[model samples]
Target: MIILTGVGDVKTAIESLKHGAHDFILKPVNVEELLIAAERALERRELLIERREYQVTLERRVEEATRDLDAAYTKLQDTYRATLEALGSALDTRDVGTQSHSRRVHGYSLSIARTHGVPGHQLEDLEQGVLLHDIGKIGIPDAILLKPGPLTPEEWKIMRTHPEIGKRLIERIPFLRGAVPVVWCHHERWDGTGYPRGLRREAIPLAARIFAVADAFDAMTFDRPYSRAISFAAARTEIHRCAATHFDPAVVATFLSIPESLFEDIRRRSLEP
Candidate 1:
């Protein structure tokens, strides 16, 4: 932007500079000065361009890292889902007559959770909680768990530990930690008479409250050794009667709001391979 002219005109030099000229060379240009000014301008432009390029590259790297993290997290969630399914299937094999109880309850609980606006990872956690709620029974003595007769008061004490046991077993598992509340509190009654912690009413987590209703209905309508299978309608009636006492009244109301056909469909699916 330097203006090289024959005259040593101060006014012209000032005008050239006002119009963005970097320097004004006199009639006989100082070759060294011209070279230095041009070099300095190029250096400043190069630095600015390099800085902008670095910023763009840095932004791209950060975006890529975010995408990678999200993909890895999604993969982790899928692995946990598979592991939990295997555990539920294992329970079916280990316990006689439970065949699809875990799966059924998982389906039922997921339905209820969705109705209450719970979704995504929270829904997944609730499913795991309900499916593995009885996993602690695995630790109970065969004499107590497999006993055909009613458990004695002492035996009941041992049976009750399953919730705590279940909680302890999976406490170390990162994926199952969100499920611990349901696993520990599912057996707690609305009236606070239920086992382990005796937590009542709102003291119970909503996930567990939702689960209790699903578990009861599934147990009654499904075939098991201790009871003959009852009709789904009959199971609904029994649950409705127990509302606010054995189950959360709000949860029962919501549970009943779901179409009976949906419950029937879930039951039918549970029967499939």
Candidate 2:
């Protein structure tokens, strides 16, 4: 701005300049001096406007670039999920009667986790962990993994290494690192009798504890080559009875609180093409 003032105090000129005045002039102004100051002030105003417009344009471009990056990230994440799902499906099909088991257990574990108050950000990790809980079975021999009857002690010992194997497999991937706990500890028992690490009670990660209940429940309620499927109520009763031994008591309670209908719905949806 250009300020024309009757007061010629040096302090007044300085103050006007300090208050964003481009030029300060006395009232007995020379027309040529006044015109020159006016031009300078107009130029300064134009420059300020241009700077503001440039900043706005720059911000708009940044926002657009950020949105594009976000879209690319989301697509990449979806592709990873699809690849993992295919791997999980492959693992499930390797067994004699466990087709869709990974998907069913994934849904069950996620529901129980949500009801148990798992944080929203961690749910993706939980889902990946549950779907790939048995991924280590890929390392097991077909003879033991697909045995029509009960496994012998030696076979059982070999089979129990799958959790560690799965852990090793998943931890190597940066994005899947969050899922390592569940893959490694899902077979662990609350009473410290489980395999690989024998993590007990609260020592076991909550995601692993949650998966234990869901996996056992799915096993009991689903038909296998060695056994027939039981009613959901019966499976729930069995799970409740085993709480604090085979499963986390708190996770068991949360799993029980979920409606049986929800489990059925998940199962039906998993079967969809």
**TM per model?**
0.80, 0.95
lDDT of 1 at 257: 90
User: Where is model 2 more than 4 Å wrong at Cα?
Assistant: 18-20
Top candidate on TM-score is 2
lDDT for each of the candidates? 0.87, 0.90
- lDDT per residue for candidate 1 within 24-120, as digits (tens), equals 7776878898898788767877888999999999999999999999999999978877788778878877776788888888889999889978868
Encode model 2's per-residue lDDT on 1-273: one tens digit a residue.
788889999999999999989999998889999999899988889999999999999999999999999999999989988988898898889888888988899899889989999998789889889878888888999989878888999999999999999999989989889889889998889999998987889999999898888888888888999989999999999999999899888889898899999999998988898
Report the Cα lDDT for residue 146, model 1: 74
- Clashes in model 1: which pairs? none
Please report, as a residue range, the 10-residue window in candidate 1 with the lowest summed lDDT. Answer: 20-29
Best by lDDT: 2
